[model samples]
Target: MKNTILRFNDAVYRLCIAVAGLSMLTMALIIPWGIFARYVLGSGSSWPEPVAILLMVVFTFFGAAASYRAGAHMAVNMATDRMPPALRQGAAILVQILMAVVCLFMAVKGWKLCANTWNQFLGEMPGLRVGVSYLPIPVGGVLTLLFVLEKLFLGDQSHRRVVRFDLVEESEGAA
Candidate 1:
């Protein structure tokens, strides 16, 4: 059962990373084209800007979930690191609980926002629903919530430090 849950979590983590990466890649391609169209071609494209904004929203939220799962989210570990073992464990638990609360708040509020805007359309892209753009907020929140639970209960292997053999080999060759 634990293994199954861990595998599911891993799958979600990979999905978040892939989606974020693709969104960023799409934005990278779109922005340059937008600039070229506006400056060189002398006609600005309406689609690129809105599309880029949407992609950015997706990238940021999903990337955040992936980062949190990997324990890459910004955190000051100075105080916790110095604490005694028992205290450290307690502190960690407290932090996780706090994080869970925050994630819950985000999920609830984001869903409400998404639902409220369901009937509204984007100003720039009339065909697109405004609620669709707000989707990442709740999705990211839920992902983060699951990751936090996994860390709290199952232990988080994602944050473990790892040495890259390829990087080590390259460095040795450089010397």
Candidate 2:
């Protein structure tokens, strides 16, 4: 059951990444096309503005997921690192649990926020409707929270060792 959950989470994370990348690509193209149409073709696209906003929303969520996976999110590890090994471990656990709680809150809040804007934000866009753009926030929160929980427990071999990823990162990039 646990393995199944992790695999599902991994699949979801990959899908989120793909969707975000597509959003970024689409946004990039739309912006350039709109600019080119205005300057060279002497006309502007009405579709690009709404599309760009949607794509940007998707981009933010996916970017956050990627950052979470990469451990690029900010951390105040100074005090944790200074403690003894046992205390450090405890501190890490405490901090991770706090993060999970915060992520859960984010997921719930984001869903409410998106629900409030539903359909109303669905303006003209090149891709999915504007309201759908907000979908990524809750989706990303779930993915991030799951991934973090997995790391804290299972330690995904494909990603990084949970307790000592900084050393892994340092070594992996070392000359």
Candidate 3:
């Protein structure tokens, strides 16, 4: 049962990522076509640039959520480093829960904002005409929540120890 849920979660997450990626790819192709036409053929595109920006916004938010799901977000844990291993893990879990709550709040707020402007359109840029700048918020929020829940399921919160190695040419110190 647990494995099934994990598989479903991963599938859903990947779908979101694919959607975001397709949007970006389309935007890139469209914008370049617009630019090339305007420059070479001397015909201006009706709305390529604005469309690109809108897609960019979507890409950023969705990408962020994807990153969170993959555990790609960064944080410093030096403060917890000195604590005993057991205590350190507990502290990390606490921090994760707190972060999850904050993210959930943002998601709710963002979804509300998106809902509030359902019939509205962006002024001055019709091609950029998305009523919701709030899409990314929910995406990020949900992803963060998923990550937190996954962490709970795993029941491990040990902070990874990173070893930075300095590679330098070996010079004799005359020992």
> lDDT (0-100) at residue 117 of candidate 3?
71
How do the residues 109-130 of candidate 1 rate in per-residue lDDT, one tens digit apiece?
9999999999999999999999
lDDT of each: 0.90, 0.73, 0.70
- Predicted candidate 3 versus true structure: per-residue lDDT over 59-128, tens digit per residue: 8777776666666767677889989999998897888789788888978988888788766777646533
lDDT of 2 by residue, 1-175 (tens): 7655654655666676688789889998899998998899998878788778867987887777766766676778888879999998888788778878877887998898778877564546534544467777787778778767876886533454233345545876994
Indicate the TM-score of model 2: 0.75
Candidate 1 TM-score, true structure as reference: 0.89
Task: List the candidates' TM-scores in order.
Answer: 0.89, 0.75, 0.74
- Model 2 residue runs over 4 Å out of place are 1-3, 122-130, 156-175
Best by lDDT: 1
lDDT of model 3 at position 118: 64
Write down the RMSD of all candidates, one decimal each. Answer: 6.8, 7.5, 11.5
Ranking by TM-score: 1, 2, 3
State the displacement of the C-alpha of residue 73, model 1, in Å, after optimal TM-score superposition: 1.5
Clashing pairs in 3: none
